[model samples]
Target: MGPTVTLLISIGLCLDWAVRAQQDPLPRPTLWAIPSPVVSKGADVILRCQGHLGSHRFQLWKDGELRDERNTSWQQAEFMLRNVDDWRYAVNYSCRSGQGPLWSELSEPLALVVTGAFPKPHISSSHYYSAITPGTTVTIWCYISPQGPSHHYSFALLEAKSLEPLQRQSPTGTPAAFSFPSVRAEDTGSYSCVYYRKTAPHMASWPSQTLELTVSGFLPRPTLWAQPGLVMTPGANITFWCSRPKMSSLGEVIFTLWKAGTQEPLQQQISAHLWTSFLLPPVRPENTGSYSCTYMVQTASARGSEHSEALELVVPGSLPKPSLSALPGLVVEPGMHVILQCRQPPKTFLNSLTFTLLKVGTPQPLQSQSPAGTSADFPLLSMRAQDAGNYSCVYHERMAPHQVSDASEVLEIWVTDALPKPSLIAWPGPDVASGANMTLLCQGPSWSTRFILHKEGSMDTPQDVSQFSLTHVTPKDSGNYSCRYQPGTNGSLWTQPSDPLKITVRASVPSNTLLITLSCVSFLLVCLLLLAIFCHRSICIAGALHRDNLKRFFCCPCLPQGVCLPHHAEAPRDEALYTEVAKERPSEPSVSNSKDPEGVTYAHLNLRTLNKRQADPKETPIEPTVYATVSLD
Candidate 1:
């Protein structure tokens, strides 16, 4: 009963435990879950088999007929109907699982409901109304039959033909609704919706009813028609018609005729489609422009269509009055130019124009057939007296078979010739000799002419001499004179005169001859004064020499009396003394001594007498000393 008994008991216990575990694996299937009641047709339906271990294989049946069987990898085996058909409506379906001896009882039957197809959505005619004019709201309804408590329905509005969804909403029951607050013409089209059951997986019902919607509102813009084309001449009557297809059947139409860009209608409130006629009776140049029309229905809302296309009115025949003016006024001088401008009123269609210049008081123009439009210039080349005249112009249009415009106002012109020669005449006749008073008269045929006079054989040029006169004339004043005449502008030419007239004037003595003689004497006196001034200058030079000698005499120092002596004959000693004396005495006179020294004096009466005595030895000897002096101190 030791190790052998213990090993046998352990093996038996392990085998028994294994047997019990196999007997108690998972519980076998007793029931299967069924799909919900009231499922929409054309939607998938599923059945589920649930049980314990060893229930891998299961079989599903519809009304006791085996529809499908499958071995399960899942805890519960599944049965599926791809899109339930009408034959599956309210049908009994069940499921069973497990092998021969261990097979489970059949599950309770499930009542499968296949709902009717979803009804197409519908919208009433009244559901399509406008927000403006015939202001109204639009309503649409989505309906599905045989409703279920667990079923949910949704409504949507889709664009016509495109099927593009516009809006969506959930409904509490089978029928759903959608509304538009303001309906418009654009809201007209097909609309649809769909429903589904919550109990069934992958079950969406078919589309509900589809409805066509038409929104009523104002008509689109009315088209316009006229009796003739837009451009018409004067006196042509035009009729305009306005109509719209939508509003054609409605009652009491009101039409209005209007010119483009103007709010006030030319005609209004006419009852017919061919509403009114615009009569351009005898239309003038001013009546041309663009025209249009509008149509309205006489309802409480008074809805109106947009205006029609424009029609242009034109006038062809009439031309406005033309006016002409010269740029610089009339009466132009020779060789000058003038501009003649022609013009018509504004907004007038002037295709062509012309201008002309005429002589005064003459119908025939001096210049004509000039180019057209507003202005032209009149050139008076080297104008003659005959070129002076009155000028006017005419204007016209260039349309085929040309039409002429009214004549312009007339303008006057005057032209004159160059200046003329003047005449010179001596008054008291040309026979008057020298020493006569005279006057010169310059005259021309017309007093309007200006006179100029010139003298012959003289350097002076001609000068303006309206009048000429002389108080007195001398022989030097004799000369021939000529004159030229310039006429003032009276549309006349200037003139030239004949050769100069000769006049003679002789010299006469004047009363101021004494004064002349006096002037001559005064001039001679002035000459003599100049000569005396020259001679006085020579005498002054001689006096200057004598004065110089006197100054030299006064300036000499006095000789001492003892040192000077006169020359004398004596013995040798005496002679020696005489030499001494001679040495002391000066040859020139002593300036200080008035008398000769005592016992040593010499005398002289005149230099000439002394010179004579010296020249002649026989002359008697004079006293040796004229006077003598004795020195005391």
Candidate 2:
């Protein structure tokens, strides 16, 4: 009985001890993964679930998912992965201790790394050749074929030559994209990329194909061309030509046209022509805005050049008309400046319109930029009579060349510039002979239709002629003369007086010259009369010794046939008979005293008439001419 009791007590004590030991804490173990932290591709690796607790059975879990379990007699239990390339070998790992079909608290998670499990991710760019414009944003994406789960891939962009990485991004799905902002020219060079899982950070694929990334300066800007003209009308069809002034490469170009206030812009591309063309089927009033353009080389993911200057386009509806006005006075005078004003509604926008002045019969319209308040001023200096014309003005849009308001009421201008001072000239000299002809000439502008010649004393009536001519000029015709001209129909358009031209008229000959000529003629006639009387007396003494011969010497009229008739048919037969006749002759008075009548030299008288024949007559004696030689005593 005593022995039985002792055995039972001992059994109870043993049971108590066993029960206490069962209540003790299970083993908190640490896992030993063979080839942990980094593992080779396709290499077998083992996870040893070991614990300080007595139980040898264990379980393994990764990222909260059960990976494997095992129960063995050995204190160290191992879960083997035949091929390390399996996804399970590349994830977070942990172990716990327990019998079969039972589990313990999971051990702290263990991170594992599998090397050479994946090839490098494919690297590419948005551009055709992985080129980018400096100082612009660019995106590089690393792609893994057969895309993996989200947040499973980590990507890096590395400089190939240096194997240096700029930075890393958050884990993402396959084909992870990395953005580079404000890229610079120095970033250019050979580049590569690779990707790995967060769990196996050290394990990655081979480097992707090397990509040559080129960073370039800003691209050249393209030019914009609009159809028709800068000005346009509403609903007008227009075309635009965009081009690069020059080309340095064969790569294509992208062009974009931006509207001043609109979000969307027109875009186009070209690879061949230096220029590109775009067409607008029809325009609208909403199209009124400033337009500009920009461009980039297609090979460079479009870091654009600066935009062009904005070209204003306008399409006005129900625009206000402009009014025309003259400054100072409506009637302008020559040599004075005239001011013309064009005014539109003050409420109208200055940028939307321009002012213009139009004259009737004028081919060109005088225009100016719209003033700040819709008014413009024009000055017509040195007004002319020809400037007189119907004038008006209108408001028009700058962009729409032909779009304009109705012309304002006509404002007639009477320019007096044509009434310029005339020039005068005299023909035949300023001083002239009395009987000569003279002319006064007036000259002015060719437009002058009328001319007037005026004399100083005869101002009351001016000669209406181009040239004033005086025939048979006398002293009365000599005076101060001037001329003026008129242009157009303006009665007040007569020109200023021309410079005066002085003239003088003189008589035909001088009095002193005529008096001397008459006296010389009278003296010559007296001398001729005295000589004639002397000759007649001499002839009387020689003929007619009768009473007629004694008559005082007085000239007798010529006898018939101018022969003195010899006064006798026969003369005295002898010299004695002639002597008697001479003695009987009457004496005539003598004037000068010196020799008197004897000095006359007629005292010797010899008269012979032959009654007897000569003794020896040659060729029959010719009768002597009946003559008597008489002497004056």
Candidate 3:
């Protein structure tokens, strides 16, 4: 028996003693229970073991390493876990009596399943059930089991259904939280997260409860935009567009447009992701109204956003033409009261009325209003020239006060001063002579009927005279003449004096001188006429005398004795008378008669006559000489 055999014998005896000691039931083995096998990391878990008797102490071990030991007066033993990890799972633990070489039998293996690391970071929003404004920030938190220890955690966010990667966050301490800044509409969707061991990125755990993180506060604000501003002309193209605010993601937005106060929306379902616009190609006149729009999110938890302010629309049309009128049309003179009336087409309200009185060339305004109703007046003073001018009035409806009325036809007024003094105007100018048929005319241009002509410096008052005239104007008629005109009984001032008219009268021609000249010319004419008549009578008288002598001498011889002698028979008486004449003759006649030879018979007869003359002077004895002379006869 060497040292080796002695060692082997000693080891066998010790083993037998260990087996007999295990069979002895003086102190029973303690059993430890790991309560709540599944637990999140960084969380506290309890390992509890109880004994049938109260006189026992408990100790906890993991992989045969001492974790905790305690002496208790009660039958229960408990061990608190500060932090849990993957190494702490499937641990063998037991309980033992206090300070003794005796230990309890090893209890059954207790398994722990850590369910939390960055526990599926849940994303919550202020408005979780409704849409939110774009460009707003939201916060999400990572939580684990309530009993877990505080530890650092790393988190990530992903699309819920598609599992598309969205955002990742840095590691944070226990109860980790993350913030999304300036979120957009595209961020609106179903979202989820997971937790992983800090040192091992590939060895990640499943999400807790599949927390449905519906990200909000990322919806676009609905916009209202239209074509025209105030007036939308008929037949014009008008378009309305409903869109999200600019610089926002289109995938997260849904647009719907509606007219204000209308039950039916103008655009029913507008998916901004498809078109991003709601267009009304041709806007009609009837579509004029107030309009607005709303926005929605495209996530599983759909929600509606706020509406936009209303925008007004208007249409265009032509305005109607205006009309005008006046009150009294008869003689409108200064100093006489009259109204100027204006009018227009019948309308709802009297908005604008304007009245104006314009002189032909004046630039000043008389009167003006917005919509004119009836009339205006011009009071009468003593009518003057300046008051005479054209007058008119006009008006229109209230809504469009700027619309003007058609100008009325212009009217003219006649005004006059009191009766003017009568003044005379001569046709052939000034001076008139006497015995000349002169016309004296009395003329007054502005005289009011009653005109009187008077002599200047005369004692008599003015006579009711229309005109003054003289048949033969004399010097007496020459004087200063003045005329005045008055309207009524009261005599007014006299007119300016007429220039003095001088008339001169001349003497008449003598009657005798005029008759003498007339008689001399008449006598000469009568003498010439008488001489022509005398020549015509002389020729006839001479022819008649010659015929008578020839008939007496020749016809006497052929006649019978008694008839022929009878013609000379009265010669006896003639012879007696011849004897008497011969007796009276002188003897001196014989001497004178003897001078001519042919007169010898006359001498003898003369002597005889002388002798008988002497004798007969005394008696009738001279009959013998007369008988001889009678025989010769």
Candidate 4:
């Protein structure tokens, strides 16, 4: 038992502890308040730390700040925090286990947001807008308690309906403002915000109250017209027209007409145009009310709206009756003017009145309000047949309970301006091709019973039909043409002369020039057709022959010169020669000469022979015959 043995035991103990710690890895501990996290003032609470591993030491932490550390090998540890309810709020708790010195990863954070430690945040706005215009920038404010620690928590702005976060902010202080630019309809909804611990982003306080946002572009006020004029008698039908500016690209506008003191609208309509008419049949005193209207244009991504000022409908009982008369004689000719005068009973305060003149079968009336007059006249300029109808007038006081007078008796008038000038037009335009059929159409109003078509020079006798047709129009038929119409066979009543219409017939092209052009085109087409046919035949012939047969028949004259010349496929054969020459020289010469620039050799043979050695003077006998000429220079 010396010092060496003692040191060996110490090393063995350290190794054993390290091995056990690695096997278990120091389990993470959980902390919980003894009397629940929500408590009153001056209350004492115990933070009980528990874990699976029997650790030797436990450390307590509040809001990521270490509180206390105790050494004990136990399954549970409790640290008492007294008088926490006095000043502490929005506190977070966590714990970690330790084996001797090494510590485990921190446990999940617990948010102990005290019951009354902090005040709730409130959502506020300065102007409190009911409707906002698109593309306008807006800001919203969220105010919280002023006593919270800076950077202790972060803020999250969320949409309340969907619970989706729109923005997040790091806590610097209380009362944070969020800005939205180019606001659109999609931004319209309920909004709320919450503050969560910075260390534990998930643990958050209660959400603040929600605020609403709306997007609306400025829309012009709608125009309201009460047909038969706002002052109508009972049992008479009237229609209201609410029209606004026309916008082709906007969504369908929904028009709502509401009467005062009514919860629901009296009428609703959806249309794409700027105008909508609401008809109220058989008007009664009960239908009288101060009516106001508004329009809504809603789309998938945005919304727009406009509202009209209110108007009061006056349905009056028995009262004074007015008289109506035409200024000029009846039967007003076309282009002539006339006036209808309505004379109401003279009153001391005539300016406090509104006068309306209406015609039978018409929806609306001509309304006029004079500041100091008892008579109102409606002028009819350039009178026409449509303007000829029964007419009447009425008046109403401007005070509430709007006292209206009885309508005057009907006055009949006639507008002789029937059958407006007929329009003369030519088919296929005013210019016509030679020998082509042409038509002249005389267009007049439906009331016109008869139409007459005339040429400029033949106005005395005109065609009696509405249209004049020429099967074959020649140059002679081309002239100024016009037309007019009569009113229902009343020949005395006729429309003014129509604007002059001229018809021009063009001459035909020369037949010889046309024939030459056709001939040239035909010639070119024939050449192209021949070339195509030759090419097709050559391709068929070429493809029919095999590679081995190409050499001999390649010069096959049937092939086009273009194919054989460019490819050089038909030329001389490499195996044959055109000429041959041969020459024999004696190796042994009969005589030898010197090797010089110019030399010569001589050869001789016996002149006579018999058998192998016989010789005759006339015949030479030799193994071979040879002749040579010698020269030296």
- Best-fitting candidate, measured by lDDT? 4
In candidate 1, which residue ranges exceed 4 Å CA deviation?
1-122, 125-219, 248-250, 261-263, 269-286, 317-633
**Each candidate's lDDT (Cα)?**
0.52, 0.63, 0.48, 0.65
How well does candidate 1 score on lDDT at residue 382? 58
Q: Give a tens-digit lDDT track for model 1, residues 1-633.
A: 899999998888877756655675434454333333434566665677786654677877777788888886655787777766655344667777764234555777764535454434433333434332334566676555444542354445544333334666666664556777775544544665444443323234444456656445644455665556433445766566655443223456677777654568877665644343444345433444456777776767576666776654433334554566664655457777666665565677555443434343542344544365565566656556665555555443433434444445566554534333455667788757666788777775443345556676665443345566656677777878766655554434445554678877766657699899999999999999998775554331100001111111111023334543332233122111111123222233322234423223332222345424332444433333122122211
Error of 2 at 289 (Å): 4.7
Model 4: lDDT equals 0.65
Candidate 4 stretches with Cα past 4 Å from truth are: 1-217, 220-292, 295-305, 308-316, 347-351, 418-633
Model 2, 19-45: lDDT tens digits are: 655675455678866644445577677
lDDT-better candidate, 2 vs 4 = 4
Candidate structures ordered by TM-score, highest first: 4, 2, 3, 1
Worst 10 residues of 3 by lDDT: 541-550
Which scores higher on TM-score, 2 or 3?
A: 2
* Candidate 1 structure lDDT: 0.52
Task: List the candidates' TM-scores in order.
Answer: 0.21, 0.27, 0.25, 0.28
Per-candidate RMSD, Å: 43.7, 42.3, 53.9, 30.2
Q: List the residue pairs that clash in candidate 4.
A: 132-216, 608-615, 608-616, 609-614, 609-615, 609-616, 610-614, 610-615
